[model samples]
Target: MNISDQLSITAKGNPSKTAYIFQGEKTSYMELEGAVTKFASSLKELGYEKGDHIALVSGNSPYYVIGLYGALRLGLTVIPINPIYTVEEMRYILKNGDVKGVITMDLFMDKFVALASDFPEIHHYIVGDTGADVSHAQKLLNDKMKSFTGLMRTAELSLERPTIDDEDVAIILYTSGTTGKPKGAMLTHKNVYSNAKDVADYLKYSPEDKVIATLPMFHVFCFTVALNAPLMNGGTVLILPRFSPEDVFKVAKDEKATVFAGVPTMYNYLLQGGEAHKTDFESIRLCISGGASMPVALLKQFEQAFQVIVSEGYGLSEASPVTCFNPLDRPRKAGSIGQNIWNVENKVVDELGDEVPVGEVGELVVRGPNVMKGYYKLPEETAVSLRDGWLYTGDMAKVDEEGYFYIVDRKKDMILVGGYNVYPREVEEVLYQHPNVTEVAVVGAPDPNLGEAVQAFVVVNDTITEDQLLDYCREHLAKYKLPTVIEFLDELPKNTTGKILRKNLRDRVTQ
Candidate 1:
């Protein structure tokens, strides 16, 4: 079934119940259903055809949710982008995705305005919590459907758009490629809806369950587990624009949220200065960690502090993001990421694509409904990742005798800061733009709170203070992508072949 059907089902269950709680705005499920119907009619009136790409770049708000499902009802590909990206990155994505329209807030207008020079195809631009001309404003706010309330009201919702099955692409997610560019993963509607069902089933969430939607909606974890899972289950999702540890705890306590989903850094920060006693988590039934690995020590600390168990899960962007998770009813191993989720058949395979013993570390492979169709436009990379309908995750891991999986290391040099994926090469590229440094190499260092941090080693050509380079990095990199640790060395490690060895740098610092 199409995901928007959940809206109709939920509106029938408890139409007046609060569906979202932002900082100042609150909308009931019935009101949310109304907003979605109105917006879908507005989109149709504005000449938005089925299968057109609609980009959403906004802070955490109810607007993101309404915009997303409204497009899905119309069978449009929703491309969610990080508002923290540099202009160059945004430009590349806009052009590559062939976006027909965009919904954005006013704070970051400069980048899109610059992009407007080259992107004339984006004819429909709707500003949310921002300003636009009268025509654009009326086009968005105008509700042409006088009596329609749900997906059923919109007859123009294109049920005949070439028979949209579960395999039809619904969301296009961009991941930092190993080749120094971004690759878009084409996630089918079946991939996401099934994954959300698996999540809701694993977590045992119900209609009364209130999930704190703190993760950015752009990320797959937020898309499937945090947002869509709750929506599909007719649960309440409280939206927060960004992540703040103090505020997250307060929201959990205020809203009496039953499910608290977060990354490692948020968990660590909650543990560092606050007393997360049983009272603070009185209503919390489940605590989930994803987007990165949760250290064994931190997991234990959180459980001990709050007197609640944390189930650490694992996934990738290409797999609609929810592949495996520890069940609440079963025994949970500390270091294991848990058993395969839903219809997924998981195994650890060696370099030759052969299965390895339970004790040895190898690449993790999964065969499931959650696996994405392929990369949007890159067929060669997609072929390399998919074999016999199994997705080969480049994460070095192992399964124990009892079928519990543990991640030993990452096959790629990616850093996880707060919950954001900061590719080392991406940060290094920004450092190269600096005129003061002669050479720069960014590597992931073991961090206590964040799973890992982006650390930069530089060889200076002129007199430049560390603060100056940091300021420059702040200007280019996103808040979480900025290097937290900086050091100066005479030169970088190089092998006889003159290729810089990142392993040498990581070892020299840690050891």
Candidate 2:
């Protein structure tokens, strides 16, 4: 079923129940459905035909969900852009996707208008909020956009959902590339629906569950796993437009959120939020971690402190993102991404594409309902990623005899130091074991003796010296897996996706 139908189902069952809570404003499922149908009509009024590319550039907002479901309801392609992206980055996306129109916020209007000078393909620019008079706004959503309260006024929408098959592309989510020109993953409706179902099922979400929306709506992690999954299960979502560790606890406690989804850094921040011990966080029953591997030490400490275990999962942009996750309602696997989900088949293979024996490190490839249709307009890249219906995820991992999978690191991010391959993730894992090491990233530095020396950029929790960290890692991990050179950094460079841009970190250090 289409996502709009899911929202409709929830509206029928729980019309008065809060579907989304953001900035003290709540929108019921029925209200959210009415808003979406109105916006879909607005798109129709603007001559947005089905399959037309609708580009959205905004942070996580109640309107973000409205635009997303509205566009999909009309059978249009929704391309979500990172709100932090510069006009140059957005230009490539606008022109590349041949976007017909945009549904952006007041804050992004100026930057978008600047790109319009170069991108002639873009036509309509619909501004969302009534707070500002944005340029080229077809109309403003007014009070509904302002407070997310009131009646859903009908817009006399005539736009019919375009006849789309399971294989038809729904969203073009751009990711990867060092040049900052993102590669768009063309995900089909079936892909998103399947992944959402798998994750919702794995997490055992119910109508009674209230989820915290920490991750950005643009990111696939939130779109499929958090947003879509909760909607599919008819659960209430407490949306956070921007993350504030202090506010997370307050919102969770106030909204009585049951399921909380977060990245490793967010989890760390929440731990350091101070009221963690005092604040009763028992409302949060299931916590899921994605975007990066959860540090074992952090995960263990989190469980001890919060009385909730974090189920670490792994995915990238190509698999419509959710491939493997730690299964709920089963025996937990510490430091592992648990088993492959219900509709996905995961296996580790060597250079020859043959399955490696259990416990041997190999590239994790998956065949699943969640796999994307292809990379938008990039046949060669699509061919490389999808071979015989399996997406070759660049992540390298290993499986145990009990079918538990452990992700070693990103294949390209693997550092070969001292002629002995040292997976940075392995070293980082050890560094995380140190109580004082809050965040750490391992990268290969130019070394004359060893060709490439392992260097660690660490963000310490306490006053721990480099020697102390190395000694701690040495105890937990092998010598070769330990960092040879350690430097304390305020923070490591990361992309919008939260993946460490090791190349950028290296550039900063070398320059």
Candidate 3:
């Protein structure tokens, strides 16, 4: 079945139910579905049809949601882009995907206007007003740009849903490209629908649930968990334009939200912020953490402070963004990504593809319907990644006797100290245990004597010297695993999705 059908079914089942709450405005399911129909009709009237690529670039807002579901309804391939992308970054993806049109916020009009000549493939541009004063740039963009509201107003309310195959590509998600250029992962309709359904079932979401949507919609983690899962289950979503601690707490309290999905950095900020302690988060029954490994220490602290159950899951863009999640009914292990979700098989394997022994670290691999069809237009790269019905994830992990999985480090991120191999996550875990340490990232640096030396950058909340922090690590870690140098920072560099950029840290010394 097509993923867009889920929204239609939900709307038909409960037309009057609150579907989305954005910035104090509420939209019912019937109203949302009607908007999607009009927008889809608009695209069809403009000569855009099924299988055409349409790029959507905006932060968390009602416009992003409507554009996404509308494009899906017409069977168009939706390319979700980060709103803050630079001109060069935007050009590469748009060119690679051969995008026919784009629906973006007015904030990025200039970037599109500047590159309009270079990219002749883009035939349409629909800019959302976003309640911002962008009139100054309207004159420059008037030649080719169309207003999103104007299109909806001019189009009819009915749309004929396109006949879609289960394997048809629905989205082209570009990887963050830590090592090289970003490769677009072609996710099918079945891939997204299966993951969203399975995750909602695992979490036991109900129509009464109100989920907090703080993460950006462009990222797969939030797209599936926060947006797709809740809407498919007929639950309401509370969307925040940008993550402000005050705004998040206010919505949770005011709306009595049940589920909240976020990255580890957001949780760290919530714990340090003053509102978290005073605010009543009792309404929040479950919290999901992904996009990065939640430090075990931080997870425990967050649970204790908010009195909510937090489940940590693991995923990559190629796997429809979800593979494992800590089970709710079972014992929630600390730092474990939990067992494989429904309809997915996972194993830790060696270089020869043989299953590794329990507790032995190896590359984690997965096989499931949730896996992507392949990388778009990159057959060589796709063949190397997807092999014999298995997707080889470049994460180093170990499965316990209880079947829970613990991520060690990225395969390429492993550090070799002399002849010993050291995993950065192990050292980062020890650093997180320190009470004063707010956030910490460990990476390997070049050394004259050794091949690589372990170095850590830390953010602190209270008084702590570098020697003291290093001594703390020394007491808990072995000589080789300890950080040779500790650098203090106000915060770690992260992408729009809140995943720490270890590659950026490595570039500091070499650059």
lDDT of candidate 3 vs native?
Answer: 0.90
Give a tens-digit lDDT track for model 3, residues 1-511.
Answer: 7557888899999999999998789999999999999999999988899999999998899889999999999999999999898999999999998899999988788788778788777887898986766665566555467889999999999987789999999999999878788999999999999999998888888899999999999999989999998988999999988887778888988999899899999988888884444455779989899998899999998888887889999999999889999999977999999999999989999999999999999999999989999999999999989988999999999999989999999999999999899999999999999999989999999988999999999999899999999889889999999888999998899998778999999988556
- TM value for model 3: 0.98
lDDT of each: 0.77, 0.80, 0.90
Q: Which candidate tops TM-score?
A: 3
Where does the lowest 10-residue lDDT sum fall in candidate 3? 273-282
Residue pairs with backbone atoms closer than 3 Å in model 2 (clashes)? none
Residue 487 accuracy (lDDT) in model 3:
90
In angstroms, the error of model 1 at 395 is 0.6
Q: Give candidate 3 regions above 4 Å deviation.
A: 131-143, 274-278
Worst 10 residues of 1 by lDDT: 143-152
**Per-candidate clash tally:** 0, 0, 0
RMSD of each: 10.8, 3.2, 1.3
Q: lDDT for model 2, please.
A: 0.80
Candidate 2, position 185, lDDT: 94
List, residue by residue over 1-511, the lDDT tens digit for candidate 1: 6677677688878988777788746788888777776677667767787788988887777668888887777778999888877899899999999898887765555567666668767775566654433443334333321211233345342332234567778899988543468889998888887888888887887888989888788877777877888878778897878777777778888888898888765775577656754476778888888876666666787888887889999998898888889878887888689988778778999989999987987899988888989988889999999998889988878899988898765677667777877666566656765756555678888788988888999877678888899999998878888888789988777432123567778876677
